[model samples]
Target: MKRFVGFVKKEFYHIFRDRRSLFILFGMPIVQVMLFGFAITNEINNVDIAILDHSKDASTKEIIEKISASKYFSVKDYLDNENEIETAFKKGKIKAVLNFEKDFSKKLQTENQATIQILTDATDPNTANTISNYTGAILQNYQELINKDIVTPYQINTQTQLFYNKELKSVFMFVPGVMTIILMLVSAMMTSISITREKELGTMEILLVSPLKPLQVIIGKVVPYIFLSVINAIIIILLSIFIFKMPIAGNYFLLAAETILFIINALSLGILISTVSASQQTAMMISLMGLMLPVILLSGFIFPITSMPLPLQVISNIIPAKWFIIILKGIMLKGVGLAYLWKETLILIGMTLFFIAISVKKYKTRLE
Candidate 1:
């Protein structure tokens, strides 16, 4: 009994001493709880919305004031004409637009009814639907508030126009997200484990001793994986197109180029992981545990980043998957070209270069 108790104490001490174990036991749970608690919400707050009030009448102004005053939405832009709506959505800032037709006040008072069109970017159907519902609820409450003294109550008709996805198909949203997650996990996990395996088996030293330069060795190690990863990307694209009937609105060549860039970004990240990890198990664990949650939650795959708290929203900027997912949605749903997508493309390129530079520096340090 004494010997067994001593062994248990030793095991506990070993666990407490290892920083990685301590992090896994205590730090990870807290982080996961916080992420899940804050990021897993469906409710949207302070969502940016644009206004196009052709009437500019008292009724229109009051309705606009009510919308802007709500905790759910902020009036970001007030457009002069309908031509600006397309440009607004392409910029990816405004989520919904409130268009008050001309004669809103006249029609509401004389005919006892008026129309307000809610144009929502339905690239995310769930969010679009939620916005429509919330806006409708607000209008309903306003109608009730004003009708208490009038003999004939005024009715506000909202015609919701869902751009990009008329049917509100949930599949349209999930396909791009699934593709992003698959590519990130497969490319990063595989390359990290492959390089770490070489190091574990003592073959990396043999390669270093050869005539090949350090950069050449690293490139050679990742080249085969790149080819394989591209093929995997192609397969996923074809599946999204044929099996799911997903739309590809932008140029195929540009889409292919962006996909290749994201895959390289992921592969370079894997190489950086390999530099720090000493074994295949460690590499795999880091790739799976470290990358999975951030990719799924912080990437804005399912949840709206705008709805999240300020800290998580700021943290999401550093996530490569978040940028790639934006690129995918822009091309696939919005039919946007390079002119509109330049910022996100540049960000991925910068991240890829940074990862490669770090990996090369670490590789040289290992040589010393």
Candidate 2:
């Protein structure tokens, strides 16, 4: 028994000497817990949209004010005519447009019915659908408010319709999510293991001692995975088009470019994981145990981020997948180009830069 105990102690000492291994074994669990606990949410907020109020009356103005006040929407612009709606959506800055028919106030009082058109950029079908539903609920509540004082039986009836994804297909929502998962699996997780394999085999020491800079070496390793990820993304797009009958409403080139950006982000994260792990096994464990849940739960892929706890909603912003998914929905489904999606694109780019910077710093520290 003493001999067995001695062997166990020896193994632990060996493991402890490798700081990366210790971090993987002990530190990763905490990261996983925090990510899943604080970042997974199901609610949407501060959605940017346009308003076209043809009526320009007291009732319509009141409804617009109520919508503007809601946490779910931000009225970014007011359109002058129906012709401007398409142009505004094509610009991509707007998610949905609210059009109030002319004489909206008078119609509510005289005809007991008023029409409000909710025009959603349904490239992200789920988000568009949610915005439409929320608008309907808000309108319904407003109906109840005005009808409350009615001495006789009278109610303000509002008609709402969904544009783009009029069918509300659930599959449209998950396509981008699945593509993201495939990319992460092929790019980030694989890149993590590839770099750690060199570390495990001790070849990393030779490269570190060589004249080539550490960042260049890391890039060289990650480039192949980028190609592989792009190929996987192409395959996903093809399947989505041919089998799922998904429409590419925006620029195809933009979709491919954004996908590459997302792949780079995942690759940088993988490289960071490799820098923190001493063995391929450790890297794989970190990639899977530390990241998979966050990618799925916190990315707004499966669950809505807005309905989550306040802290979790704030944390969800940190997940690169969340931004990528939004970009995917925009470019693929909404057909909106860079104008509407630059913010989300910037977020992904920023994350990639941050990960690369951290990895480079860590690599230099190890060299010293």
Count: clashes, candidate 2: 16
| The candidate that achieves the highest TM-score relative to the unseen native structure | 1
Question: Cα deviation of 240 in candidate 2 (Å)?
Answer: 1.0
Worst 10 residues of 1 by lDDT: 212-221
Per-candidate Cα lDDT values, in order, are 0.92, 0.81
Task: Give candidate 2's error at residue 224 in angstroms.
Answer: 2.1
Per-residue accuracy of model 2 over 1-368 as CA lDDT, tens digit each: 99999999999999999897888788877876776665544456778889898888888888889999999888999999989987887665687899888887787678777778788876556777778788888888887787787865335454555555678787788898898887876687888987688877888888888998978988987899888888888889999999998888889889889999999999999999988888888788778866788778878787766556667778778988888888887777767789888889888888999999999898898899
Tens-place lDDT digits, model 1, residues 64-163: 9998899999999999999999888887889999999999999999999999999999999999999999999999999998899999999999999998
- In candidate 1 the C-alpha lDDT for residue 251 amounts to 93
Candidate 2 has an lDDT of: 0.81
How many residue pairs of model 1 clash at the backbone? 0
Off by over 4 Å in 1: none
